[model samples]
Target: MAQMIAPVASLLFSVVLLLLGHGLQMTIVPLASLSLQFEGFMIGLAASAYFVGFVAGAIITPHVVVRAGHIRGFAVMVSSMSAAALLHPLVAEAEAWILFRFITGFCISGLYLIIESWLNEFADNSNRGLIMSVYIVVNYAAFTCGQLMATLTGPESFHLFAIASIIISVAVMPVAMTKAAQPAPIAIVKLDLRKVFKTSQAAIISALVIGMVVGSHISFAPIYAVQKGYDAMTQAPVFAAMLGLGGVISQWPLGRFSDRVDRRLVLMVISILGIFASISITLLDQADFLVFLIVGALIGAATQPAYSLAAAHGYDHASENGYVRMAAGLLVAFGLGSSIGPVVTSVLMQYVDIDALFLFPAVLLAVLVVYLAIRVMHKDAPVAENKDSFDFASTSATLGGVVSPELLNEEDRYVVVPDSWEPSEPEEDDTEEAASVEATDDADPTSADEAVAEDPLETKAKASA
Candidate 1:
């Protein structure tokens, strides 16, 4: 327990630093882009660099960590991100910023890999749920705080960048100080494009749209708020509040209930409502708090689920052996969608105004609605009645919380390995637990806890969440 203290503290600080860095950088990026007289398309290009780089890094990160080892890989990546943040004001050119953003993305991927793999290692199977939930909460809290930091300072000078550096630099101390066992090297999972493509077209399209929506929301919402009559100071915090609170409030009922029902209808309903919210926000130029908060929350609740909706929808069409490959493919697709969303929306803002961003999502969502409507008509629509609610298990209580990958997609990422999880390599103890879990999963498909005893990570999840 004492040994676990430092690493857990480090993980907590990681949440804080990530959110703080994100909020500070996000507030700075767009304001700087406009000051430099960058076009919406160019701004899009710059923002896309992050996701583009992240995707590339994710592709290679697992292998690099395996070779260099966890601590070294984490140290290198965090330093890279920190260095990039520190360089932002110095290199201060649009192209330079884009290049820097790409580097930052590359660095953070290793950070994510290290942290997630660490959690995986720390948590045995029984407590995985609790551990993951706590992690998700911490993550959500950090992101919200990151969004809120835009109010603290602006891109007018180096103060924000300095603050970003402080956060990044501080992160290193926690990691370096921890005495926890460093994780073993891991092999990167190489995605098979040909196989994925042949399996589900929905994964491709859904990934694209999911990426577009989420990527733009994070990078541009501050500017979008500014255009909506908000000062830059007010912009970041409010947008953060919307996204941070929105998903937590809606996840439980929506995800849980959907488990027992058909999800296609839910997807259509969410998209339609999102379209309405996106379009409706344009009608409000008021200085009211309730309105923006309401709109932000609604938009968040309405759209955040799209990623899961699309992923689950695609998974419905896949074979049992295809879950992991499908997840990778969907992640790539979502990344691409995120990469493109900002530019297109930003360009739309040019012809009209900031209102274009909201309206732009509305239009794209409308297109999705039509497509799904057609699918529903053709009877090829995604069915939501299945219990794929693992990844989306957290309900309204998710607001200051984190959601775990295990809860989100267990069977896909880590299989239950009873033999590997024992305190001692007692093969007899392991086999007994395994036989027990198999019986549980067969009896209660929705119960993730039954399989917990057979896995060590599950035990860790309970402690953390």
Candidate 2:
């Protein structure tokens, strides 16, 4: 672990700082927006806007890196995010907040791309697994700490925004000072949703549903906590931390079990569990914050692994050569679902009850459980030989993170298939010639042997047929 950490320590430090500020803002924004008298739907729209930009950034940021190189791109993204963070407090209107959130999301996507790909460049097969594990640990730890930071300042003040901006600004120092050379340029990922869906319907559907569930949970759970009459300082951070803790503890075991069985079966079980957990949270007495915390952790445990399982399942069907494309497609699908989730949940809460936020996920998970149950009946699991080994993946990961060569097994490294290597259909004339040859062989074996000797092409065509 020390050996793995030595090579990318600077990059990891930058990631920790980046996630800390980003994590703090994740909760602070929704809470602050609520304090400013923004309605539930507006807050949801603001959150959805970030994901909208996230999807755009994942698709377009590679070109930014290609043009500017990793270090320069990293610097630019960090600066942009810092500026966006400061802008949030200056603007009071929901529309302005939405725009700033989108910018922040866009910059964050690029920043994560730069950091993850940089780490990938420094890792080799021997240390890649350890490196990725440490990365996940850092991710969970930093974000949880960030949520804790929210306790230091109330959402209505400027101090929290300043703190978020300063933290992001400080994150730039480690990367800028590092001696590491720029990594290879980011590759342009081509996404064909049709091809991706054909690859694994269960994986794609699960990605979308998980996106909706997580998006709502992250964006609105703080609001729900506030509605329950708990202060942001204690209840909100604890709520967020419990979710992170649940995810951190559950992912590895669930991922390992997924490797040994049909991933869809694991997914089906998760969906069913998530349905129960969501319903439990919705019906539980909100006055007892402890109970909410416990059930929220259960919700996290049930929902958090869905994305990773879905991704692994997708990879089981994807050709080794198309791993990057498949991963990118899943990210896009998840992003689309995330963009829709919060708005719908918020509207549900507006027209119904604040608890409808939890109910929204419950209904979605129920549908997913039913869908997976039906899918299980119709589709046999992929042959074990064809399955990809399960690796823990984060929903927060950018495209570069998902497709990093260092994270893949040696056999699964990105490969380019030649455009000219497509299979060709046999021509009618060739088929007819082969038929004639077969007829001759049936009629007279000796004559057929002589005919083959006369025409090598006939023999080759006959073999092809």
Summed over model 2, clashes come to 0
Per-model tally of clashing residue pairs: 48, 0
Model 2 residue 325 distance off true place after TM-score fit, in angstroms: 1.9
Candidate 1 residue-wise lDDT, 1-465, digit = tens? 444443476776765676567556765777767756777777888888887777777667666655666677777887788889888788767888889888876666556656766776666556545555666666667756766665776655688888887887777777677788764444334467677767766546655765676667766776777666666665645665686477666765666555655556677788899889888888887658677878888988887766666666556666665655665676677767767887787777777787877777787777777766776776654454534553543212112111223322234443222211222223555687787866766698645444443333321111000
Query: Per-residue CA lDDT of candidate 2, range 255-297, in tens?
Result: 8898889988888898788888877776766458888888888
Error of 1 at 40 (Å): 2.4
- Evaluate residue 257 in candidate 2 and report its C-alpha lDDT on the 0 to 100 scale: 90
Q: List ranges where model 2 is wrong by over 4 Å.
A: 393-465
TM-scores of all candidate predictions against the true structure? 0.80, 0.85
lDDT, candidates in the order shown: 0.64, 0.74
State the lDDT at 124 in candidate 2. 62
Question: How many Å off is the CA of 249 in candidate 1?
Answer: 2.3
